[model samples]
Target: MFTSRGPTLRELAVQALSSVERGYDLLAPKFDLTPFRTPDRILDETAEALRPLGPFRDGLDVCCGTGAGGRVLRALCRERAVGVDFSAGMLHEARRAHPGAVLVRADARALPFRPVFDLAVSFGAFGHFLPRERPGLFAQVHSALLPGGVFAFPVGAPPHFGTLPYWAMLGFDTVMRVRNRVWRPGFVMYYRTFPLVEVLAELRRTGFDVELTPLEGLGRRPDGTPRCAVVVARRRA
Candidate 1:
């Protein structure tokens, strides 16, 4: 579901065929118009959820595409807010949008930062990472944060089996797998790779004390479980 301002089907197909970095470069100019951009509502809700635990100092936004999460950091952190990503094109848009924020070009798997930030947040970018890559990613985040600093992100509950959303995610992952098999410099986005349990375990193993808070504004499922939750992982003090 994209607006008229978003990329065309042909553009999307071209992006899907390109490497992840180049694809995002081509799409960066129109990314906000696409559904792939993190929604404002989610950003607002996350800011609210993080407010109580914060009064934070310096902040970092990992995989900060167009600086949506950097905006969140600006609200919650008292000092500087930095946004990091590998895509120079995405960082270009981010710099224009968040002129006050610092934008850095770096891969998440090997983040180039010290343990200086008091808070770190990411939005809608985890799908790019494979499950096996998560531990290294978490370790990088942990290493980037100050002692007792927080690394937070929201994750949605799994859709009901056999439901349209479920099937849609399954189909999307299948298509991606097929595409990667057939294509070079594959774009690595997948919907089903980041399971909450596995993620929590990885965070713990990476030395974070993990916790979950339901994003009440996002509402609950029929089973009374939250439809979405914010994962707050803190580095040991």
Candidate 2:
């Protein structure tokens, strides 16, 4: 629906009606072409924002769809980068795009790693997790990292209420709620589920010391606050 190489409307419809994992599997081949993929600009700016915080040895990309976060990890990590996702097809595309990175098929809520990585990053996949599931998810990421390891991801400012973008997000989430009500094996994406205040508290509860840094290159909102910020949660040694 986004470009010539993107999925057709019919393909998107099929994906929307399927289970989340199954839907991503169906969309995997064209995922990078779709608007769902993280933009290159976001990745580049993220790398730029993270450069000062790192001298990272190894990195992990959580819910690493099509390897977007892997690219960020490659730029930051000194040794190697690895990506993990539950969708086999997404991992397949990730592997194809990033031949050097190790791609593992695993659910983010139950990451299969010891305290090995020095840094972990996720991009554009938080909506797949419900608010109720976030604590367990954060705990898993925490367990996967080494002492004092950093977990980072970008969060955008909420669109101003009554604005077109705000309404669009509200409508999309409403439709997803209704869809899930009657659907089997619900697809869990929702735009408004991850509120930053609650998220910071949850991360702290999960044993990470959290900090937020404005991504200045992405520009600022009209109120002079950042349009987007990166949440940097560090595991305590």
Per-prediction TM-score to the true structure, in the order listed: 0.98, 0.98
What are the per-residue Cα lDDT tens digits for candidate 2 across 1-237?
A: 498878999999999999999999999999999888888888888889889988999999999989988879989998979989999999999888877779889999989999999899999999999989999999999999999999999988999999999999999999999999998889899999999999999999899999999989999977999988899999988
How many Å off is the CA of 73 in candidate 1? 0.4
lDDT of 1 by residue, 24-67 (tens): 99999999898888888888889899999989999999999988
State the displacement of the C-alpha of residue 14, model 1, in Å, after optimal TM-score superposition. 0.6
| Predictions in order: lDDT | 0.92, 0.92
The residue-level lDDT of candidate 1 at 213 comes to: 95
> Which regions of candidate 2 fall more than 4 Å away from where they truly are?
none
Quote the positional error of residue 205 for candidate 1 in Å: 0.5
